[model samples]
Target: MPVAGQTVGIDLGTTNCCVGVWRNNRVEIITDYHGRRAIPSYVAFNETERLMGDAAMSQNAANARNTIFGAKRLIGRKFTDPAVQSNMTHWPFDVVSGPCDNPIIKAHYKGEERHFQAEEICAMILMEMKEITEAYLEKEVKNAVISVPACFNDAQRQATKCAASIAGLNVLRLINEPTAAANANGIDHRGCEKNVLIFDWGGGCLDISLLTLDDEIYEVKASAGDTSLGGEDIDNRMVDYFCIGICEQILRDSKMPKDQVHEVVLVGGSTRIPKLQSMPSAFFDGMELCKRVNPNEAVTFGATVKAALLSGVKSEKLSEILLLDVAPFSLGVESIGGRMITFIRQNNHIPCKKTLTFSVCKDILPSVLIRIFEGEHSMTKDNNFLGEFRLDGVLPLASGQPQIDVTVYVDADGTVTVSAIERSTGKEKKVTVSHDKGLRLLSGRKRGHGYGTLEMYKLSD
Candidate 1:
């Protein structure tokens, strides 16, 4: 029923999930047993067993407290996050802090209390999609290309990959939603140099990307979005809008004038809003918004193309496509004076590496603490803390004597590896940021311009 070595593409969305495959020289949207092309992103628990998709959504009215929806917003987020705090007020389900300060879903099922992490809930949804696709093709599927919001940080991207692993799916690649939409629009074969802007206003998030295309080479020049601005937010606030702000930010980041944009593409369900439909056109000075691709299936279509390319399918149209993505945020280490020294700036091409050298902050310091962070802020406290590691065996020399080189490497899949090396002694320590289980944060007051002693910090696990 299916060809050998088949791979699928999944658009794991905030409101629905869609799976597609590149077959018969075209993309086909796989439907579940009920013949539904799109499934609601819901999971629920009852006395007998668990329910997912439409069935879970049907009983949400009766089991509101146990039904978990909109888990995407909470994935890889701390309980103390302001977004989580704001969501607690509207969500019927219970969200509590775990030992690691991550949000955990509390529910009662089968006469017992159970706690499920956001990743686990996402895994359940992914597993359901896998089963649906398997049944459709009458063969087991293992590899997939998943899509995420372009604004997703390193932690969020890693958490999404972890969920795929839990569902027994090997991630071939994680494509940005807006980027995928550009692929669905078939911009690579347009046969000219053009600058395209993608406006992706979805159910729970808004992602905007500006890209340049020439000679089958597609590169993302800039990206900006807000997770809190979407269709649901419009229904909740009834008075706030973030489209103008996002447009300004994207223009500023790309350093391109509005008139220079050759084409504007619109995707996502929320783009159907009359006000939203006109916002992009107005911002681009009356440029007609391109609607060649179906808003609901654009992401899935792009993902399927990526899967086809990854699977080595012999399609002439996909043979020459080259994709070059960029990091969405800056990466760096905390330095003396509590400043953030960035080694990798936002919009830098992926699979790149950079290194910076520093000197000892204090005399006779046996070790130096390297605190990794992600953000655009100048101070360490204002940025998002990734993790920390101590590089020991320093030459125990006076301040500004020992030379320590810190290198940050990000692969094509957004995996981060940080290494610290002492030049004189050749001592080294390294860590993979995704596997970091705990974070060390400053707990004491700042004294002078140096990082305080190790004892003044506490473990956040």
Candidate 2:
């Protein structure tokens, strides 16, 4: 509502998406054209028309195969990936392999089978947000900051960026979901720093971010969670409990060890369930969860705050705060023995850099290849290969004799750049790793860099 291309923060969740705008010295979540604060993350397509949000959700049952939902899990993933294969059984819609092995949405619309990439479907949802916000502000909306899960790899982040681009929104930044929540609800102190714990259990992912805050300065201390574990898992557990009698089921379920904490801030609509509320009480010793902010809209509210800050908006409150994040996984290259040697470990603050020296494997070679990866896997083949670049002018010596400095820098913009230079010649080459090659599947299981047995690293508290 401020002006054209002004910053708007968007929470593009797997189950629901919300948009917020910063105005009048505060961030306000905008209701959609349908008067809904939280829009269902659904999209339906027919030959004649397309519907989004509640409109699309209404037709999901009748046209289940034509409606796309839960796209966040599939976006940037391959048809042969284990996660994709696991989620396939739950979706009523059809998913097929795409041109590059990326998962594709298959729907029979207007008497024909139409295919759409996950990013394309997500773009439609983002476009809906753009239209609704434009109507509310009575002006064009362009710039936005979208949030993604901390565990999302380069490919997923890239896919999200692509969706925003397709929606005609210029992305200001892609903040992690928990970090955004901490910005919105966890950091409440002024003039002093405090440790805050955020329990972000959303529809598709449960993300826990440990943060330190002083007024507006927010820093992530540690982060851990299960990407596939969230409110939906709780619901499934609830259903299983009820099948055997709720009271009996809860009694049979093993009690989890209680963790010490300061204040537990809960975000996600699923927190509204009475049963979930009851379970956490046992874990937290019955401490009251913070409800000062709306669970459903807190992430978006934080997003708007970020957009306001990033836009250089003039406000005394905005000027006093700082936000910082950490690299979620270890990034490095493969060792000769198939070991993963980490250059950057998890929880290292962002905009950080690390340099590692490497040598050529053979003598008198013209080039040295560095294959970058992200994960906590012990073996290089078990991690996610992001991208690779070569120092072509290398004056190679005997194996393990030549030195090439490989520097990996993850900037504040959430993009990775890897640079390699031959120590002797000072020749260098750099590659910015983002969406395009982030999720490229190695077809042969054997390549220049061995096959990556991709697995989601489930970090526990």
Candidate 3:
């Protein structure tokens, strides 16, 4: 772990990235060379070739093929995933297939064709944040605590950690985005316990978390989210509505062909025209919605505030916080007739264990199928399968006589381990499942995966 003095809190966001430091007994946001506190997430590679930020936001209209945005939607997801497939259909930029059939963005940089993973795109943004912090602190910043969406799964979290490595950062902790938001909101209140629900609606995802704070311990009681729900949907809606208006105008004027107008309106910035500034009104027509926060800046602002709180310069007493975050979906096993028998419910507290015992219905039933799933759906086909294990070589026993005990344990880090024991024979089998892609670091084999390791990313004969 890096020393506290050398550590910083970074909010690597989907729309923008912000860095904060502890200085003069308070958290301070670092300003970039451009004098901007928040850096636009947009990135562009120009003809002569230079990467640009805020300056690139408007250039997308002219060089749509070289500009990239909303890469967050595809990060850590398989190319075959429904959400990624759906986004590829309408994304302005090109989505090409890459490793593991993952979606990679292709763009022209300085007359050279370049391919980048979503993680690499995010890493570039994080690197910019690191530059801003290092310039402000006048020292090399090595360690950081990064915030991720509360409902991010093991794969998504791992992907973020990998991006941190690519950005030349050592991630000390992966804090939940909502928990960080609640911390920024002062949920502690001098040790008074409180339950706060964080409803995070960002450009590419929606996360809802139920958290409880008690005497410095913050626990997540439940978490749920839709990977495809967010402000991007609203933007698409606006784009569609704007195109309709453009087509109607062109038809009224009889000035151009439908296909040409369609092409022009779709490729140009005309889609960003806020045709219905009142569109937000339709989002919460019946519910008593709080004033809608700025969809673009809220996550960055919240992250900035959190960075300050963790800088140790801000002295705020926090109530005990206990967070029991759940798997995004329910977990279960396969049963007779291809049915799913749920063993653990979603949103349950962590550090929990559950056990089930089954007797052999037939004298020669030598194997049992253990299927794991995640979701509320009762059918096995409707849920996401974590994996499957098969227990074999069961000793033949009288029907309904001896029982086999199966136990499943889930740890704080969302890892699931399973063990099975034959009650009469005293035979046992156990396995530990690791969702962390870089778990080899736990053995102290090397410092922080191969990113900075001379043996990993470096070329050798």
Candidate 4:
């Protein structure tokens, strides 16, 4: 594909959004109309009109219920996920349950009820980035390379792609957040074949990746992350500490209705009391919150660097830069004893393959079970279940004989393919793993048999 004349790099982030354009063989961050390097990813609508960015963030105090923030955590997640339920506990806004139980942000704007899916909220931010790039480059901007956390799963990646579609921008690629940042920083140490670990700490997530750079190819060796750990976690800890101190102070004062006192004390500004500043400072050990990287703006700044590189505006000396990213979680199958036998570790290189051999515990095992799981945990129940498959007709083999060989391959796009062959009969079965919910959302696919309307399932629930 021919590169668009106005290609730009965008960091569509959780708390804030930024845009970068290539110029004079370097990348430049474009300030918004308000002359800010970062624009708050917030939107609000008062009875009179709609507002966005800085103006919208200011309303967080007065209209906390209507202001929308932190939609990134909700993106690409099902309503059934425990993570979603946990996030709802801290969000000040009203999150309405949607189809598939996904959380939808609802607010009143211009005297009318306004509803937005997580995708739409993110699309609005991307569209703002598009406008910033177009105005900065003084041309029509249509194509872009947007970055996402390496640990994001297939559903999350697809959700981001959907957001791009709704924003009317063509995504050149869904680059990994940390890899893009490394590119932005001119880290091309791969010629020496060194193994470098990239630790990405952002407002909403923490991703750690190890890569082996050799010859012009960057290959991921291992990757891991805690999606629920980031700057937000630190902030919540501070908030809770503040709440505790305030409760103590209230108790010291004259006794009042407990409910009334709780209402007055637990709101916004009380959470930011400077007198109890030890909470935030104590959370960070000697100003270093976590090892490997800082949680504040490392990922965002790194993303800006990547955006510049992809725009082709960076110097040719830097153009040869290549980044290889790995899947964030481990891939494995369940064994007879419910043990998860891992084949590919997170952050391993793309276009790679690994195989494992297993013997039938019984003389005539009729069927073999293939349970796929993702996570760093060695135990089967500790990881997320991706899908399952069954291979039949195991040749009547002696107990403890190697009857089947399973080969797993992961492509560059992060698709997983598994093949199982019976050694004695040579019978084989293969399948490409896919999320049941995501497959249904992709256009032009027939609904699976026995599947009913989404509403019917809701009614039964």
Candidate 5:
């Protein structure tokens, strides 16, 4: 890779977004118009103009319905997805369906109905970061490597890439969130290998990645997360606990707090709650929470390490580092009986492929539907649906008489491509996985009998 114009990296988080560039031998976060390094990932509508980041978040209290947050959660998801349906009532804004079945965020702007997609709203945040960066550097920056959750599937990842494209930036890569944090710390510099856990608890999601740092190559062994769980959950849980405490105080003198545990590495703005410092003492067996780095700015710093690496910048501390990530969850299809037939399992390395054959359940059926899902569960209802596609134009056949082979391959960038063939007729159908039901991905090669679909990045010369 050859060096070009100025390049930067972005941490496009669910609750906030920030930009950083490798400049003058260091990574500096671009400050927004509000004089803050990281801007809120929010967007709002007004009578005369649309506002983004801090300006948009400020309107949340009084104009909540017109202030859209959490666009990352809805990106590339169908209006009918379980995640979308469950969250429909969460915000005061209107969530409706688009002509293509994608969920649209709508609000009354200037007394008129305005609709926006999750990508569009996310782009607003990205565009602001771009402006802030250009103004700070006094030059144009048009390239970036954006970070997403490790658990983000192909559709979600593409959606994020689309947001960057919309913001007029060419996305060099889409990296994982925790992986970026690990890079920020330069954990791979140690001569001896060590296993470390990254507890990425942010406002919108909680992800844990187990990684082995081996000099310049970092390998992720496993990853698990609750996409909808994070500091916000902690806030509500604490609020409920406060009410419980009040009732207990009225009934008795007081209840004693529990003990604290050992070391804790905190990140994100919510981790700064004054109660968090003492709660660890009360709940972690008397241990205290560690805030070695600024919680709100850590992710962006890590992202810059990656940005520097991807853009061919040389640093004695970070040059030539490579990252290999695992599939955060299993990738497979739903059987006719609603059983999940997985082709890729969790923790499998990326850039892998698998093929499976199926027998028809009905006679003379021209098609079969392959609905994809990701998770550890065995049943369809228990897993996360990625998308679905129909393998049509099959030769008319009797029950269990036709062979339909489906080959799923995940590319280096985590884009998934599925191909189906009718052995009898030689008719084949291939689709790049998208979320309106057929576009998404996973990557990696076989670990054992089954492989995975997510790999971090390879810094090849």
Candidate 6:
């Protein structure tokens, strides 16, 4: 029994997950039946049934190979990716390359061998969040605003959305984690101009976002991060963990002087470490780190507020705020001489569309292939291959006779949709390009299954 307007915000983190909702004029963290606010992001399979959250995590010692943690690290990544390959050595569980070259976890469930995509494992965690929310609200809730690291590319973002769909939740939006932290602090509502630095060091990633606020609009100036570096790394080398390198890197990349940053807002559990906290203070020349909001819960709080706003909840404090995000990397397609032609450059304002017109290289071409990629590299081979589609029935015109428009559109949530059109015949071929053909979630491998195709679901506009 889903309530029409029930919406919640989910912080689907690498090391943990939290859900919250706007209630009684403020954000309230939804607790599980045991009254725990934060839940470990772990899923385990055993003799009789699958376990989630604490249940899954507590038994991880005995079921290390069957317990799945850090699935977020594998989501939307190719099995051949250096990062994935590197992580594989440390994980106790087995990961095999899928047909699409994506990583798939293999574990024993009910005395049977089973394989699961990263998206599926994440979906189980998301389903637990949905159930927790439903239990708290006493009604079925479907819509949510989930947060991801600003560094997540198109494929990672779409895979996250796909996980939400599998969990039976409609994503109102996929927000950047640092941006959500800023909202939790009501930075835009402060009504004063300032340059704020948000340092988000979580379990699996560290996102540094520099934002400038004017009136009520918050524009992200620049964002930089190491997707594979986070709190877990710090824990491994607690004695020598210093984020000064990344702090200086972001400042250099954004070209912002340390003194100019009015406030250094800290997000994620890692910021609580005194050594980690001191590094930022020293780097910024002793400015106090803002800790007004709970480091672990700020993301959830902001997401809840955003969910409330999207749900059309009437609240004065939630209104009159605008947030603008940027494209983390340049998006383009393979062109002549194996080069890449960028349609959307890195740091470009999003919810934006850019089009490039071209003609077939061959005089009488039947079709043209659009091999899309994302990165700042000059060649497609050096960039991350996103996906591709073929536009056929081109009318077999001469090299320069046809006008084909290749349009790359990025929505506010950072999901990408690419389309190609032939103006002459008004023929068009469009795709979201985020989902790989071989990596699509298929409804199979059953012991009673209910997985759906990720591309088949889209949140209402």
The top-ranked prediction according to lDDT is: 6
Estimate, for each residue in 134-181, the C-alpha lDDT of model 6 and write its tens digit: 888999887999999999988888889878877788999998998898
Name the lDDT value of residue 312 in candidate 2: 77
Model 2 lowest lDDT segment of ten: 452-461
Question: In candidate 1, which residue ranges exceed 4 Å CA deviation?
Answer: 1-5, 187-189, 235-241, 435-461
Displacement of residue 314 (Cα, Å) in model 5 is 3.2
Stretches > 4 Å off in candidate 5:
3-5, 78-90, 187-189, 235-264, 274-290, 357-369, 388-405, 421-428, 435-461
**Candidate topping TM-score:** 6
| Best first by lDDT, ranked | 6, 1, 2, 5, 4, 3
For 1-461, candidate 3 gives per-residue lDDT tens digits of 11454667776666666676655654466788878876767877766644546877768789888888877777777788888889888778888776556677888765667666777677777776776788878998887778777666656666777777877887766666655655554432425665544455555555555555565666665565566755666566643454244324323333323232110100001112354223322322422222233333334434444444444333443212334445544566666566777666676666678888877677877776666665677688886666667777778888787568878777654556777777767677776653333323222334432122322322320
Listed in order, each prediction's TM-score against the native is 0.91, 0.87, 0.69, 0.67, 0.77, 0.92
Residue 156 accuracy (lDDT) in model 1: 86
Model 5 agreement with the true structure over 1-461: per-residue lDDT tens digits: 74576788888888888788877777778886667877888888777666777888987998898999888889877798888887786888989876567787887766667666787677767877887898888998878878888778767887887667667788777777877776765532457665544556678776656566778887766665556665666766753464234323312311222221123345666656665445434543555555666666667777787778777887787766878877666888888778989898766778789999988998888788888887778998898776677877888878987489988777655777777898987888887765422122111111322111111101110
Every candidate's lDDT:
0.83, 0.75, 0.59, 0.63, 0.70, 0.83
Q: Clashing residue pairs in candidate 2, if any?
A: 216-321, 216-322, 361-399
**TM-score order of candidates, top first:** 6, 1, 2, 5, 3, 4
- CA shift of 16, model 2, Å: 1.0
Deviating ranges (above 4 Å) for candidate 6 = 1-3, 187-189, 235-242, 395-402, 436-440, 446-461
- Candidate 4 vs. true structure, TM-score: 0.67
Clashes of each: 0, 3, 20, 4, 26, 0
Give per-residue CA lDDT, model 2, range 290-360, as digits (tens): 77777888889888888887777888767757787888778887767878879888777898898888777
Candidate 2, residue 207: lDDT = 71
